[model samples]
Target: MTPEHWLNIATHGLALEAAARVRAEYLAHLEDALEAGESAEAVLREWGDPHTANRELSKAHLTTREARYLPAGYAPTWAGLGRALGEDAVPLLLFALTALAELRSGETAITLALLLAIVAAALLRWLVLSRQMLAARGRATLYWLLSFPTVLMAMSCAVLASRGAEGWHEAGRLLWERGWTGLLIVAYLLYHFSRLLTALSAARKAEAQL
Candidate 1:
């Protein structure tokens, strides 16, 4: 069968409870617009894929993405900031934790220096990584990604990094203690989330509920 045919069959035949809810919701909306003469097929066509539908429903229930932009020290446009933040997170986390551990024991001078060295390495990775220039594209909404596991990972890492800095846990706190860095990442995630929500909320409703 063709890809579209398979997509339709698969989405229509899916038996998950959540999928049922989405289908039900779509139909409810479609029913309310019956005078418009739009069939479920037409509605689904505009809505795109079942994957997209799933993402919309999930974003309604979750925070969705993390580190969508760069911090105040980062001097670039939103796209540049997003790339830099995502690229920097892991290595920075590694460095901060390692450095903090050494610091707590009062002997991190060299270790701290090494962590400083990694800052550039992380920047290099961010510079060379396989990120799509999301902020650069006005149409790059993340709605079709929520149900996907990666979206959750992105969401979780961003959340942990934010709250990870707020308490007495020095290592974890230091990991995100760069103050504005946290804000940059949170703002970026928010922007990405807003786009995802807009797409999910605006998706055309389907008829003849599954």
Candidate 2:
């Protein structure tokens, strides 16, 4: 292939921000090879197929969907969906049950408060997920920030749970009366939040190596 054709293949998937630099670098490499008495086709052949070359060149500039955390060509299966959504699904089911119970008991305030809390939590979760999506767009800073609110919220919950355990006896009993589901929820949040932190760390490390 011609030099321009080779450059196109190698950079087809690269980010716009990095594409120019990468193209220049590849062009320089080709020029150096030509000056060394190498033919254009030989140089391109040594670099391998365009798709493979593109994958190599684009690693550092890959989006979150293209990163190692998500991988390229990720197909969604029912089992995978279950794994991804199960935690949120459980809370949603519990919320629905609690809402129904409150409605039946005519506790309008409790029902309203529960709905509002659910909405707020869902909104916060979406904010965090949006940050994660930004991180996938070659922004390492957002990946690092992914765990901040989760960690902060988890710590705050722990503190409140502790205070309730010591002085807020009635509230503690109420939580217990919920069959220890509060504890389970707290643990789930901690686990899920930590996983986000871990995934971001891995993705950042992988990108850095590129």
Candidate 3:
């Protein structure tokens, strides 16, 4: 394949800045080999398969999603913050509203306290992800922290279902009690959890490659 074509395929999923840097480095290497009297075909052959290079490069660099979470400096831009937290924040907000509706009037304080705790956990996650280049162990810890709310919600649903000893019918009732907001929260948390796991797996694979 042509150098341009190979580079394009190899840098497909990387962030823009990372793709540019990889392209420049590879181009320079190609130029140096040409100056040493190597044929273009030989140089390309030495580079191996572009798809293989693409997978390795993707593991080593920040993805577009990951890049959005990286802050510019001491103070991150509003746009960046919004993009990083939008998926998470919206679900948390809905959970808070629905939780308040679910609890009795006297238990409003409990709902508020629970909401604050969840929000704090989420902010801590954002701070670490933005500020640190986490290793696999760190990613594991983050995954558990993010999973806390999901676990709690699942346990609550289980308890509700067990109350009637009616199985799936009771589970359906539980959902009705919480409304669509509950489903959204569960769906978002599961999606986010899977994303974190995928990232952790990628990081481990990259380290293995190194």
Error (Å) of candidate 2 at residue 31 is 2.9
Q: What pairs collide in candidate 1?
A: 40-207, 70-81
Please report, in order, the local distance difference test score of every candidate based on alpha carbons: 0.47, 0.57, 0.67
Tens digit per residue, CA lDDT, model 2, 114-173? 445544544443444433344433433333232334434544566567776664576567
TM-scores of all predicted structures: 0.23, 0.39, 0.55
TM-score of 2: 0.39
lDDT value, candidate 3, whole model = 0.67
Off by over 4 Å in 2: 35-37, 58-61, 67-114, 118-210
Window of ten residues with lowest summed lDDT in model 3:
67-76
Worst 10 residues of 2 by lDDT: 66-75
Model 3 lDDT per residue over 25-111, tens place: 999999999999998889889999999999898877756665543333212455544544453676568768877687765567645
RMSD of 1: 15.6
lDDT of 1 by residue, 6-47 (tens): 344434433354345655666676576555886666655665
Cα lDDT for residue 141, candidate 3: 49
